[model samples]
Target: MPAKIVVIANQKGGCGKTTIAMQVGGTLGRAGNRVLIVDADPQGTATRWAASAADESSFPAHVAGLAAAGGKVHREIKKYLDSYDYILVDCPPAVDSPVPQSALLIADVALVPIIPSPADLWAATGTRGLIERAGDINTALQARMVVNMLQSNTSMSKEVLEVLEDFGIPLTLAKLHLRTAYRQAAVFGGTVHDLGREAAKAVQEVEALAHEILSLFKNN
Candidate 1:
């Protein structure tokens, strides 16, 4: 079967798009899925993370940088479809960026990560427009929003969720919280799964997200 292409995208920076992509891809790979991560952002955040690995086996997924493939990216990624179970595209932070649009063209699902803030919510609207426009060309594209960097027991987080519920975008129940484990994992060149007992919560969050995404694919 061809790989299910998922684009981790948001128009705004600091939304943790790269973190989510790596975690989700790593989770799936650890679960025995053949996963490939395409670094589409010119900043090469995902590429850098892959490079920081202590060893090739430290990170679960295979990563390749293809910054700004533009309209050709959709067709370019096709060559890898038959070789992997999942392909995740780490898109640029700008909605106008060509890579995001190109990734959307071939994506089965677009996972938008939004931080719990009014600015992030506003940024999501622009991303939604980009996703909708891509939908005109790629009819199979399904967009879902995931809350990232959420602080538990905070009123701001609650408000963000309430606002997003009315945003007309499908929100995933698997939300990622703000935690040091994620940062430590990034620095240590591994995912939360590689962390010790201190990262158990972070590991669980990633696993849950991976399960949710797989379920979405299965249903679709």
Candidate 2:
């Protein structure tokens, strides 16, 4: 099967892109698929979290690595890509960058994480333009938007839902609600599974995402 490459991206910083990538990768790995995580954030937050998990629980299924930059990044990606079943690239925060461009160029599936705000939607236009410029993407690639860190009971939440609908982006029904467990789980070097309750629910959500991703590979 052709490897499914997904870049968890957003032009804005602090949108939980890294967290989403790591958690999704972790969930997939736990579900028995060989998962490879590329920490493209130069800051290496995802790499650090993977390291913490390895040090604490000795997570056996995850293969997390630091991503290279410049034109060489794509070369490095191509070199070791086939060894895993799935590749999750944690793209940099900036919208304009060679790394994100390279990632989008090769990505079979791109996931943009939106924080459910109008300002965030406005910032997404640049990323959308980048995707638009890369034609024939539907043949070799695809893209979707997922709402993260949602607080569904607020008025802003309703507005955000309307915007996601009007904006014509596919919103994932499962939400990573703004909960203390999300923060606590990350610091402890684990995911919602370790924290329990809503965190576990969050893990289930991501696991469902993993299943959807696996289906994409099957249909291909």
Candidate 3:
């Protein structure tokens, strides 16, 4: 069977696209799945994050950077389909970018992470449109909105959730709160899983996202 492609894309920068991709990719990899992360962002954030790992073997998944494949990225990614159980693509933050459009053409699911704010909500419309357009071709494409960097126990966070429902895309039940563990892990390499017992909550958040993502494939 070919790898189930999941494209983590949002046209707005600072929406934690790389963080979510790396965390979810790592979580899935640790589950014994042969996972590969395709960094399609020209900025190469995901590639850099993976490189920073102190021990490459402990990084969980394989990382590849294809910064400028543009429209041909879909074809390029096909080469890895049979080799990996899951392929997660981290796309550039621009709707005008061909990288994301191409990734969507081959994606089983497109996860759009957005920080709670008006601008983030507005930006999601474009990503949603792209996924909808891709579905016209891919037929089975599922696009979901992921609320990222959420502040805990705040009315603002609750308000954001209410507002997200206004957007037409389905929202993922799993969310990622703003936590220091994510940044610390990124700087030193490895994921929350590597943080051990002290970072149990962080581990749970990421694992939840991974489990929710895997369920999509199971249902399909």
TM per model? 0.96, 0.89, 0.96
Model 3, position 140, has a per-residue lDDT of: 89
Task: Pick the winner on lDDT between candidates 1 and 2.
Answer: 1
Q: What is the C-alpha lDDT profile of model 3 across 1-220, one tens digit per residue?
A: 9999999999999899999999999999988999999999888888888888986677899988887777799999999999999999999887678988888988999999989877788778888888888889999888888899998688877887898988888889999988889998899778888777877888998999999999999878
Q: After superposition, how far is residue 199 of candidate 3 from its true place, in Å?
A: 1.7
Q: How far is candidate 2 from the true structure (C-alpha RMSD, Å)?
A: 2.2
Q: Among these predicted structures, which one has the highest lDDT? A: 3
| Model 2 poorest 10 in a row by lDDT | 57-66
Measured with C-alpha atoms, the lDDT of residue 195 in candidate 3 is 78
For model 1, what is the alpha-carbon lDDT of residue 6?
Answer: 94
Q: Distance (Å) between predicted and true CA of 76, model 2? A: 1.6
lDDT for each residue of candidate 1 in 183-207, tens digit (9 for 90 to 100): 9888877789888899999998888
Preferred candidate (lDDT higher): 1 or 3 = 3
Candidate 1 backbone collisions, by pair: none
Cand. 3 TM to true fold: 0.96
> Which candidate, 1 or 2, would have the higher TM-score against the true structure?
1
